[model samples]
Target: MIPLAWYLIFSAALFCIGLFGALARKNAVAILMGVELMLNAVNVNLIAFWHYYAQMRSTPYVHGLAFTTMVFVVAAAEVAVGLALVISAYRRRQTPVVDELTLLKG
Candidate 1:
């Protein structure tokens, strides 16, 4: 079995990469992808901790799985709403670059 620290380090690295992608991009789609990556990293962490906790306590784990499922649901909804807004903005502004949007300046 893999150690808990390995999973933690991997999740941390994944989250950092996602953070960089989100912050260093001008395209709205790319930013959304980055956000998704970050969400996935969180899921990995949750599962890893859940497994370790169950092993240490000699009990079955269910709460972490439930929480992770909720996170997945929330992420899916976020993607749907985020893409819809991005598409609407693109149609109105003819650009999908985040820095070029000024629709809320009024």
Candidate 2:
């Protein structure tokens, strides 16, 4: 059986990579991709913990799975809304770069 520590390490690395991508990228789409990656890392950790918890309790509770599903739903909604805003900004500003689309600047 794979150890929990290994799963945690992998998830942490994935999350850090996502964080870096989100912070370091200039494109809005790339930032969205990074956010997706971070959400996936969170899913990984949730599933890992759920598996361990089930093993310890010797029961198949579905709370973690349900929470993960909700996260997926939320992530999907976020992407939809975020992309719509980005597209709107791109249409108005003629650019998708995060630094250039300064709609908030008055």
Candidate 3:
């Protein structure tokens, strides 16, 4: 069987890459994609931990799965709202650059 450490390492790398993309990207869509990547990394960790714990112990591992599901729901909602806002901003400013959104008086 695959080691648990490998899963965690991969997830950590994905999370870091996502974080960098989110922080360093200038485009709103790229930023949203980065956020999605980070959320996927979180799901990976959750599932990995659940698998490890469920096998080592006799207790149920539903909590982790449930939490992961919740994260998916929240991520979906966030993406929907975020994209809507981004679209609105793009319509108003004609640009997707994050730095150009200084005037939120609309």
Candidate 4:
């Protein structure tokens, strides 16, 4: 049986990688992908905790699984909205690069 600490460490590493991607990427779509990665990392952590600690015989933590499911739903919605916005921006500016979107001048 893999240790809980290992799962947590992996999740933390994934979260940090996602954070770096979100911060370093210039394309809006790439940033959105990074955000998704981060969300997935959180989900992994939640599930791991639920499995290791919440399933105790005394005080079950099944509630954490529910919260994790909600987070997944929210993450899906966020991806939908974010992708829509990226498409809209690309249509308006003809480029997906974040640095080239300075066209607010009328």
Cα TM-score per model: 0.97, 0.96, 0.94, 0.89
Candidate 4 or 3, higher lDDT:
3
| Model 1, residue pairs in steric clash | none
lDDT tens per residue, model 1, 5-96:
99999999999999999999999999999999999999999999999898888779798899899999999999999999999999999999
Per-residue lDDT over 15-106 for candidate 4, one digit per residue giving the tens place of the 0 to 100 score: 99999999999999999989999999999998998887754657785777897999999999999998998898899989999888776657
Q: Candidate 3, 19: how far from true, in Å? A: 0.6
Please report, in order, the local distance difference test score of every candidate based on alpha carbons: 0.96, 0.95, 0.94, 0.89
Model 3: residues with Cα > 4 Å off, grouped in runs: none
Indicate the TM-score of model 1. 0.97
lDDT of 1 at 54: 87
Model 4 misplaced regions, further than 4 Å: 58-60, 103-106
Each candidate's root-mean-square deviation in Å? 0.8, 0.8, 1.4, 1.9
Worst 10 residues of 3 by lDDT: 97-106
